[model samples]
Target: MTAARTEQAPGTRAPDAPENDVVLRLEDLVVEFPAGGGQTVHAVSGISLEVRRGETLGLVGESGCGKSTTGRAIMQLPRPTGGAVVFEGRDITKLSAAELRETRPKLQMIFQDPISSLNPRRRIPDIVGDPLVVWGRRDERAKVVPEVLTAVGLDPEQVADRRPHQFSGGQCQRVSIARALVLEPEVLICDEPVSALDVSVQAQILNLLEDMKARYGLTLVFIAHDLGVVRNISDRVAVMYLGKICELGETEELFDDPVHPYTRLLVSSIPSMETVTGADIEKADRGRGEMPSPVNPPSGCRFRTRCPLATERCAAEVPEMREVRPGRFAACHYPMLEPVGAGAAVEGA
Candidate 1:
């Protein structure tokens, strides 16, 4: 485990942030789904996060960790079961359907699968222009669609008449981005936007997104399972396990010195240049297990079941997210690292 460095706390923020600084805030957000047989799947459990203006906040976790669910809740796709979603200081969860529709254009989502996101029967222009049409800007789409298409590295004249089937996966993703940006949204939720693309194409799309963010002055909530991708693109990163955030801090800080056992596992799991053979693979498998089902997650700490350092206290009491070090927060009974004189010494110190 890495030792916690003493630095100014980055997680601490003014209660009243400047009006222009915070684009979105999620307060104790919760989302649940009916799984039939009187069982409910706790997809998201009291997660709170904020997206600062012009910054990318990465939400990372394995599949079924509720990263996507948290993103959708912010957009009020089905409205969360509990907690408040404040967008630009207004509680969007309380907005009526008509009101939400009017506000939806300002918050757009780019899904994981690019090919399926587009309409196969619709032409590129119409598909990209759909949001504009919905917002009563049909006539202006002629001007808007071409500009967005060009911005996303596609030829306006050549692809304008093409259907979804005519484009490759990378091209289709570019088109999807063009469509999402056509409305000139303020906050863009990119849910694993590059996970489905080829590695070479993924780099292209990532670069394109960075360009688009600057051009549009957009705030981003980037959700992904790839730690490298998230660290490369995000200013801050939040680590989720099961349905709760286990750690949140600056990307470089979190990756360099993860305080949560789960986070350490994830960081260590990232593939390196060195080749792994028989003995190394066996040694690497020590104390690791498959993720538990969210429907019946562990009682106290959701991650306790698989956490290597879990103790009886971890199973008896839920660990709240607290500042384990300056600007870094973790929810663990025994954080891997701690600031000097804060509590029990660092695990190996």
Candidate 2:
């Protein structure tokens, strides 16, 4: 059975509740890829979450933790194997190809790879205006293309006729963002938008996205592996591990007071020059191990293999996400009451 959805604020709707303030809701969403020898890669396993309109919901996790897959699943790039993706009160997973194509304009995604997402042969104007052309707005391309290019901090006059290959990585990303914005999409899924850029360029792209969000009245799903970046832009953050969300809450709350062992470890692992000494490094190394293969993940809690708090119980049954604080939810039998460094209980204690 799917987990029960949690309630939101007065004006907002719960995942299972009637659609109101919520723009996107994932109900027991599952995505799996088939491997050879009849094996399956469990990409996303029963992740149910809600994204309210006008809010930036951050999805963070280590590589191979299904963050990107979750983002793709939301767009139905490849329809999920199980569960539902409800967008604006409609079940998109159930929509036919023709029906889904009609609904695609409102939901758009900015891919992780800046250079490859765009066609090298296509000129900037033609690339960014492709969406308009598809939607029978070729006549309006002259106006819309330039407007969006400028909105993304690119000079329309200079870049309009240029090919994507001529621009830098940062410039290409700006073009990609411009393409996504040309449609004035309501929900924008940014899949590691800044991961491939230099540290200096990352800030520029992030600031530009914030500005675009306000200008377009967008609701964003920002996916990244960097906790610092996620915390900076996300109103609420979801920490994913092995296809499931282990902890979720307000960004500040999750950063300052992480409840799950995995969440705590991730927060502590953030690089800091002042805190990179012997003791800090030692603490960071604790319970560290390679991520288990998704093809044959651990039995109960997928994170138990690397969790210091693992026990027979943790291996016996899967933990359901429950409210640990007012708006914070964690899927752990023994959620951390204090920071992980403050003598939190662990296995074999």
Candidate 3:
């Protein structure tokens, strides 16, 4: 995170954000799929966010919270069911197939399963350079491929001729990064890029991403369930619940003083330095009900069933995101951090 970071409250300009600097924006994005028997899986619902140039925006949430779906929606992978995906001042969702293909080079994604993302039969150079060939830069593939491969710390001489299975998980991820960078993209959506690796390897991949971001002058949308990992890498963090954003703020601020009930639970559940034994999953599970299925998410506030602060109003009306403090926003009728004139009604108060 940058020392001079600006807080990013939705619908308001940060002091540091100049007009035309936002690299990507999602407006009222929605994604849904039929679950058979007249049911619908609400993967993402009415979520809006933006990523500024050269900034890393972290999307944090537990499994099935739609963070990964949000990232894929940004790529227009399935063409979002509603709303727009604005990239570089254009709504990519409206682009024709040819236009979208042309725009893809500027927006790339790194999937969670690195080894599976690569082809088991293809050599490294062919895999990394395939984008060039597909995008009509086949002539430059020979020169550009090795440069990015070397940039990602893989020796072309050694790994370029080998297949993905030969490399360890971390090395395979490096290859994935190299492939994403081959197009010199401005935005990289990393969906849990380190979740499958060893703890030590996770650090290496995170550092590698930081290096790659700086080297390419890239903006990143980093999606992961690990709060600790997001804290270490993201400039700003958006905490998601069910299918919507519950809180958004600068990294340290959100972690140090979480305002949303869900955010508080997530931050507290992270293993502290004193608790090397790791988070007490059983204990944490006992404190909250099972996350509702997206096919039938709770009305009004999806987290009300588990929130200690939930009220009748929380169940009756949806909470719109509002500024809880300077540059921090939370979508809760009864936020953990109450306003100055409001009563303090949080748990353990």
> TM-scores of the models, in the given order?
0.90, 0.92, 0.91
Q: What are the lDDT scores of the predictions, listed in order?
A: 0.82, 0.85, 0.84
Model 2: CA > 4 A from native: 1-19, 274-285, 345-349
> At residue 216, what lDDT does model 1 achieve?
99
Question: Higher-lDDT candidate among 1 and 3?
Answer: 3
Give per-residue CA lDDT, model 3, range 94-205, as digits (tens).
Answer: 8899999889999999999999999999999999999988878899988999899989999999985799999999999999999999999999999999999999999999
- Residue 287 accuracy (lDDT) in model 1: 48
For all candidates, the clash counts are 1, 0, 0
**lDDT (Cα) of model 1:** 0.82
Per-residue lDDT over 115-190 for candidate 1, one digit per residue giving the tens place of the 0 to 100 score: 9999899999889999888888899988989999999999999986799999889999999999999999999999
Model 2, CA-based lDDT: 0.85
Best by lDDT: 2
Model 2 steric clash pairs: none
What lDDT tens digits, residue by residue, belong to model 2 across residues 81-104?
998888887889988999999999
- Candidate 1, superposed: residue stretches over 4 Å from native: 1-20, 274-285, 338-349
